[model samples]
Target: ADDDECNNVTNICGEWANCSNTNGSYYCTCEPGFASTGQPRFQTNDGTRCADIDECAVVRQLCGPFSDCHNTNGAFYCTCQRDYSPSAGPRRFQPGSGTHCRGNHRDMANLTESRSMLAEIAAKTSGGELTSMEVISYVEALSLSSSWHFEGRGDMEATPSVINTTLTNLVEAVNNLVEKEELVAWTRMAEDLRENTVTKLLHSVEQGALALGRASSTPLQLDIRASEMELKLMTFDLAQDQLSVSMGGDHIQITPKASNGSVCVVFVRYDSLGDILKPSSDPGSADYSRFGGTGEITVNSQVPIDVDADVTNCAFWEYDLGTLQGHWATHGCERVLVNSSATTCSCDHLTHFAILMSSGRSNLVAHSNILTRITHEIQSTRTTIHKNLCCSLFMAEFIFLLFCSVIAGLLHYFFLAAFAWMCIEGIHLYLIVVGVIYNKGFLHRNFYIFGYGSPAVVVAISATLGSKYYGTDKVCWLSTENNFIWSFIGPACLIILVNLLAFGVIIYKVFRHTAVKKPEISHYENIRSCARGAMALLFVLGATWTFAVLHILHETTLTAYLFTIANTFQGMFIFIFLCVLSRKVQEEYYRLFKNVPCCFECLR
Candidate 1:
């Protein structure tokens, strides 16, 4: 049995396909289906066994010609799907190819349109039921302003699906909201636009404000509020107080009212130096305040050497601003007083009045501190010009040498020289009163020249240079008399720099003197006090120049007009500061004029 179980030998010729090995002989009965290669059909000692065979030739026609057919040794199969279709071509589905045919352009366009529509709908509805994409689109278009320029890149004639969808969504939302609340959805839309902080939004807001004002029951209050807002937002103050708003039961009317007060207030303030200071009093009369003069003077160029010393009203004065000297006097103002006498004069107690006569009682303060400082500037400029002339021939060789020199002087007086002198005067008073610096040496020689001459020389140089090269407008003289220079910028800057320097020096000196701990030891106890006074003067100069430069540089006026305006009230700042800010100056002011100062306590 062991030998039979163990393979000894087998024959394939066994009678059966199944065969078993024995020690000597082997017999094989019929096998199940196939016989092994090593076994004999009837031999007992034969080798192998038979295994079942799978033949699919019976299902030969399972797949049609659309598929390929494959047959194994005992099995066969066929694939007949569209993927394997013969007419589908080489690139359709291959061993290693990816190319495939797609639908036409119409299909793509329809797809894009649907996408756009969905996007638009989402935007318009902001997603009540619309797609999430539509909500995003609406949110993006909400904040629009004119600052952004739009590009028209898509089809011109066709309405974008996105836009259409958005509009539809918006309409639906409005209808729903309106039916629910009876509120105008359009107004809400406008408000939304306004909230976006866009330029167009803001502009719309402003227009809405105006419209609201027009529709309001009380417009005067609205006007006042609007005016106040404007003034607060912008640096320049408008002449609006003169305007009156009246409600006559039915309609509201707004109009300008002329100034009609008989009693005029002449306020006087001074620095410690007994110099008058200027301050903003009234916008209507901003051109003339304190020591400043307003109005125009014209020289008759056509007149052959006039034998008569008479100043008459100009037949044709220009206000067009384009022509030379066109901006001075249009038809000769009645308020203007053309005076031949060179004495200090105030016309009708108005700064706007032309000087026809010289009366020391100009109903105006000299703005003494400012004047003194300007005087000093003139002196400094003169020294500088002198130095420049000595050092280099540029001042002489330049065609505008004279013009520059004149402007330099003008700028000095107008800007710094005058203010510095005023501060010095303030210092003098502080020394005498507070610190008791009674050394007679304190009042130095050449004080007046330092205060006045320096500025004049500097202005003279500036004017000379500007006139020769830039233009033709005279300083301190009539425009027609000498077409020298109307260049206000150079002169104004030089003046500002000089005054700023002076102001800094005075402030530093004051702080320095006050820092000393031994106040009682020194005989010049007034040093600190003098410094304070100098600071007061500095304040006046600083204030005036700060505002004045702006007014001068503003290009709203022509050359002649600019020059005249700049010169007219240039000294008013110091005048107001000196007379209004200081007690001593106030006393001096009353003493000199024998009149009550305007709003004295308020000035202090």
Candidate 2:
């Protein structure tokens, strides 16, 4: 009965076991990753606890260069080596560090590759072996001189020191290539000296690296050096872009060259015409006809033309370029010549002494050879043009006149005032006809102001204002061509508006006064002609303004003359209409013109 009863527990290990009364017992032990302590602490579960082990301390000197392995509680850290400072940029690492360690072999492989790549680049650039004593010296100097420093460092690194080291190394290579006699030989074979300088310099640099070994290897740093070379070449190329010439009253010949050494010759002929175009028996040929000459002539490299033999039309133009009478024929050199052709010559003209040059160089360069000469010619020509135009004196006078005219009176304002005077005249006429002036004393004063003093004030103001707007010109009057404001728009509109209103008012007064009861024949007879004359004057004023507006919109030179004619003769025309033609006014005008003094005592 006791044997039939069973237990559920079982002994599972030597120290720690599981027991089962009815089943078999088993032994238990700790795994290889764990270690056991002999002493057991009194706890609730009573399980065995083992501390983490440091394997690195146990296995020393196993990790390779560029890597460090560390052990912590239950963990370890393997860090990759850092070449540059953290602040310099991101670090180049073979494998990640911290927590997940890369194999030691992999880290070593990455470091070797990095070093090899750097060596290859430096070798290709300097045309020297990376391991050579000279190259190593310069590389060490560059590292010390670099403008970059380690993080948290105080002293600033020197960039120029590194550049100098690199430059010295490159210069040494250049000298080596030159000493080999390759540079001199290549330059001798090259056509252009400039090209030889550039090509030989470039090829020497490439050859320099080859001398240092790794002739077939390409380095990444070669791109940087090539870029620097390109920048230097471009700067030199732009420095010689333009071709300049100077024709100092002589004939010149020159050959121009491209960057590639292709030759082109340019001939230029400069002339001066002064006494030849003077007015004489040839009135029609004075101004425009004698001023005939091409402003400039340019041609490539060509043989020089004989000034004495090839020159034709009149001795003055015989040596000129592109003339109507004189022509050119090519003789020897491949030249672009500007020969004196009769087609562009002038008779009785003063011509500049021709300059003829024969050389395989540019006309502009050989002519403007000296910088001091360039300065002198520019200054002299500027002074001559100003003096010849008479502008030196004309400008001073113009400025003086402008100030005086403006202070005296503005012309356009006077024009408006003149229009106001015309209106006043119309009003005076109306008042006279209406018999509002019972006394004769007012007539003299009113007529003087309306006819003379008002016009004078208006004229003064208009003239002053006009002078300000016009500044200076060939003629004194305002015209569309000169861009004058007062003479064109101001006077034109003012005249039109004033005349229209005056005409309308007079017409309306005549109609109103005669509407209700017919005035006596005497009244009618006295005002009729005056009214007609007033109307005619207004019509003429309007027509004058209309023409001014038309000229402003469409500047016809002939119309400009018509306006001048109208302005110049207006005083006489007005006198005819307003004075001599008017029967009432004509008697008074004739008496005034006779210069006869009236005597009241004589009548007595």
RMSD of each: 33.2, 35.0
lDDT, residue 3, model 2: 38
lDDT of 1 by residue, 1-604 (tens): 3456324444444333555566665556555434345533444343444444333344543334334445544334443342222333452233223223321111112323322433443344432442222222232332221111112323322233332333233333322221212222222223323123122221222222222222222212211111001100011112234322121111111222343321111111111100100111111111111111112212111111111223322222122212211212324333223322221222222211121211121122222122322222213322342222222222222312344434433433343454444444444434443456444433454555565566566566655654433222222221322323233335445545655666566556565655565566454656656655664454444334444455434422354355444444534533444435546656555565564466554434
TM-score of 2: 0.27
Residue lDDT tens for model 2, 441-546: 5654564455346546645554565544342232232322234444435644764676566566666666666654565546666478457755555533434555
lDDT: worst 10-residue window of model 1: 227-236
Task: Give candidate 2's total backbone clashes.
Answer: 62
Model 2 alpha-carbon miss at residue 69, Å = 99
Best by lDDT: 2
Which ten residues in a row are the worst by lDDT in model 2?
227-236
Q: What's the TM-score of each model vs. the native?
A: 0.22, 0.27
- Model 2 regions lying over 4 Å from their true place: 1-241, 244-416, 426-470, 473-488, 508-531, 534-536, 539-543, 557-562, 582-604
